[model samples]
Target chain A: MPEFTLWDIVRNLLLAARWTVALSFIAFLGGTVFGLLLLLMRLSGRRVLERLVGIYVQLFQGTPLLMQLFLLYFGLAVMGVNTSAWLAACVALTLYASAYLTEIWRGAVAAIPRGQWEASASLALSFGQQFRHIILPQALRIAVAPTVGFLVQVVKGTALASVIGFVELTKAGGMIANVTYEPMLTYACVAAMYFVLCFPISLYARALERKLA
Target chain B: MPLQLDFMSILVQWPLLLRGAAWTIALTAIATLLGGMLGIVCAWARAGGPRALRWLVGGYVEIIRNTPFIVQLFFIFFGLPELGIRLSPMTASILAMTVNLGAYATEILRAGIEATPRGQIEAAESLALTKAQVFTRVVLPPALKKVWPALVSQIVIVMLGSAVCGQISTEELSYATNLIQSRNFRAFETYIVGTLSYLGLAILVRNLLYWAGPRFLFGR
Candidate 1:
């Protein structure tokens, strides 16, 4: 067996950490766009749209994300649509992040006082206009801190993509552990990398919450 | 070719599914009990203990919260053996989950405890109650009532997270699903059943906690 040093494990894991970063970026971006769409649908004042979005949120939130990853990765293959772990992890994480983002953004929107809506509507603004001009701006401000906080969750969540064989940080750590026979050292390095990635965002989120409050 | 979904092939293994679900619930139950107690102690320490102890507990909370649960599980299961502490997969999973939940609960419960009005504590102190009595009787119940919803959500998250324990072959619900799928090659169907079962369990557990919190933990 090739001798592996601590530096070898850390360096390789750092390289693999890029994929974790990339996946989180994609999932957060996709989740934001998709979650916004779902949020609008829920706020659309149509009963069917509202209920549909509610069930969608409940369905995603109520299940294990591991199951979602499995369903997307394996389910797509069974459907004869060629599937890669990258595609499955991206899609699954996007959907998972969307469900959560929608809820967070929804709460932010709901926090807007009823008077804002009433005054906007009294101006004869259309529902779309009211949301676009009056509601969205205020809601976005309230949503920013929680949204940033959720990014930490997204980053940590990419660790799960390892199980689907996407070979990001955790997967690379597993590979290195096997080679070095240093499961303890390797996994410790893995956790440290995640902490380095996530802790700053978590602190920033806390700061934002304090500022907003 | 048209898609034909056959869930029966997976459902036919109901016994395995039931056992898997049972294990999942059992693991969650044990973790919740142990972790809740750990959380209370740590919260008390952080809220009212000495400066050094508070700093120590704060460090523990930050480390656990910032990392992913899978990595934590791997460390306990795979890493600890290097220190001459070999644990079975089940024991490792339970310990990991308890530790994970304890950290989050400390934060959640501390929020409630800190929100306690100074006047109430003073009143209890005037009655000549001990510190422990003050916390348990005059402070804790209301604090718990205040944060019950957030605590319920965290518990549900931890329950769903226990799915990761299967990665180390803990034979939880996901493991059972994996086993059945490997046997029948019904990966998609088995996962659907497994995912929905988790959804059912999440909802059930949430409701159960919401009910039990008032009736048992803090009173109606």
Candidate 2:
């Protein structure tokens, strides 16, 4: 019966933006840690480990995040493992981000010339030492730009967590619109918030890419 | 009691699942055709059109690229009606998908277009070719070929993204899965089936595009 102000919508959305930012950070950081491990496994020179990780990456990348979210949220509940939307979203998105990150880092690692490996080996550097000192340093430089660019994707991807009822920016917009009868304004605010979050990263990524090139 | 998995219960709704997948493909097909054309036009604008047009196209690419597709879809579906422009869910879904793909493809194709050798265009011009002839005969084909793999990947992404269109009740595969789950209370099984179907679809679509892009699009 009461009217909702523009400030009210923007204010509420700003509050919800924190969750979006938090979720993205959690997913990105968690994915990066796990993805680095996957990268190590892939580069371990063991054919079986490499193929296992390849299937893992494919399984995550080949399916929709929405399906992954649904599977986790509902699957967990069905298994009588009480889970909240937040927990489920975190798990699903972390896995999703890890898959892409692993592939990206692998490409960067692969870009390192094979000579780097042989040179390190000839110098009596152990496998871990070569990877730690020789390979990863060079690969990290190549990896930075694309990895930053991929953050935009992870941010955009967090929007899907709203499907499972995680009350991030997108879900908050829907809720506000439903309550205020102002779908246009609410969603515009939501989109604007996303833009504000994403555009600068996009620009920075491009700048880093050009700088790297 | 231990958890038990059931697949046959959801698999029985094969017809509904098929219909939903048909709609997803139909929506994607329409969007891909329209969106690919839109991308080319916008790419041309960004690459070679007038300065003002380039700015306009650039603005569009940045805006669409920065937002999530679901928000874009929601805006088109729910927000437009307030402006007295009502769209069916299917119409809005296709429109959203096309716009999303167009923005992404514009950037992708512009990269290809910009990489076109200046000498090639100059050579075509000296040979008395018109601007249109130069673009069509010498530029677009190779530009597309150079970026075909990226384009195909983007198309597959849009296809998988269409699953969200079901959020608006558009009767896509995810929508059918939701329906079957609600009916049978087999939520996990229904979504599992739906996910596998989407995985299969993504693989199939990617292969088809890769196989077809060279033969049909840019030519040998």
Candidate 3:
């Protein structure tokens, strides 16, 4: 057996980090689209549609993401669909992100003053025109900090994708530790990488929130 | 092959699921108590303590908050053993959970503490109350009351995170579900049961914390 060097471990982790970054982007982007649709349906003045979206959010938020991954992974298999960990992880994470992002965006929209909606209505603009031109821009300002902060959460959440056998950073660290018998170094590197990935966004969010306030 | 779902098969292993849920609750309870106390102390340190202590607490909060909880758990459970500080899975889970919650709760409590009016602290100081008395009697209760909802949500997040504790073989609900699935080849059903239990637990814990936050921690 060959000896494993520190650089080799770092290189392998860097390679795996690509998948982590990719998965995070997939989940975040997909979630934003879905979350926006849910936000619209929620604001559309249809009580049943609003309640349906509420249940969707509650279902996702009320359970562990781990279980969500498991359900998609095994649930897909049981339904006679061929499932890779990647597919299952992506689907599960997209739904999870949708749930959270919708709620966060909804809160931001709700923060807007009531007068603006009334003003838009009086201007004879359709609901879509009012929302598109007047509402989303303002809500987007409030939503930016929190949504970026939530991206950090989504990145961290992709670590759960590892449990289903997607070889992301955390899983790769575990694999490396198994081979090198150096879990301390491997996991320390893993934590540092995550910190590097998350801390700047966390800081930016804080700064933006402060500026906004 | 036709798909046949059997919920009854997984339901038969209720004992394991119950035990797993119990461990999860126990882990959360212990972590909540210890981590909540740590949060208070750290919040106090950061808010009113010396400069060095404040920086120290701030660093601790940032480091823990930025990293994922699962990695932290793995580090404590898997990494610590290499340093000659071996801990049982249960001990490591509790330690990891407490440290994780402590970091988050510190920030939450700090926000609350910072919101405390300057006048109130000054008034307490003018009363000749000791610093400790001023914090505990004058500062903490109202701060806690103000942030109880946020703190409760954090605790619930921590509780849901306990699902990962089973990765270390601590036999939490997810672990029990995994074991039953392996035994009976009812993976989907087992997970469904586990997920529902977690959902129930989350709701139950949130209600419990909301109810207890005022009655026990602060006056209603």
Q: Give each candidate's interface RMSD in Å.
A: 0.7, 0.9, 0.9
Instruction: Residues A1-213, candidate 2: write the lDDT tens digits.
Output: 998899999999999999999999999999999999999999999999999999999988888899999999999898888899999999888999999999999999999999999999999999999999999899999999999999999999999999999999999999999999999989999999999999999999999999999
The runs of at least 3 residues in candidate 1 whose Cα sits more than 4 Å from the true structure, single-residue gaps closed, are: none
Q: Model 1 chain B — which ten-residue stretch has the worst lDDT?
A: B1-10
List TM-scores of chain B, every candidate: 0.99, 0.98, 0.97
Best by TM-score: 1
Q: Considering every candidate listed, which one attains the maximal lDDT? A: 1
TM-score against native, each model: 0.99, 0.98, 0.98
Give me the runs in candidate 3 sitting further than 4 Å from their true place: B1-3
lDDT, residue A127, candidate 2: 91
Residue-level lDDT of model 3, residues B1-220, one tens digit each, is 8888899998888899999999899999999999999999999999989999999999999999888899999999999999899999999999999999999999999999999999999999999999899999999999999999999999999999889999999988889989999999989988988999999999999999998888899998
Model 1 interface CAPRI class: high
The whole-model C-alpha lDDT of candidate 2 against the native structure comes to 0.94
lDDT for residue A133 in candidate 2, whole number 0-100? 98
**Model 1: per-residue Cα lDDT over A35-154, one tens digit each:** 999999999889999999999999999998989999999988988989999999999999999999999999999999999999999999999999999999999889999999999999
lDDT of each: 0.95, 0.94, 0.94
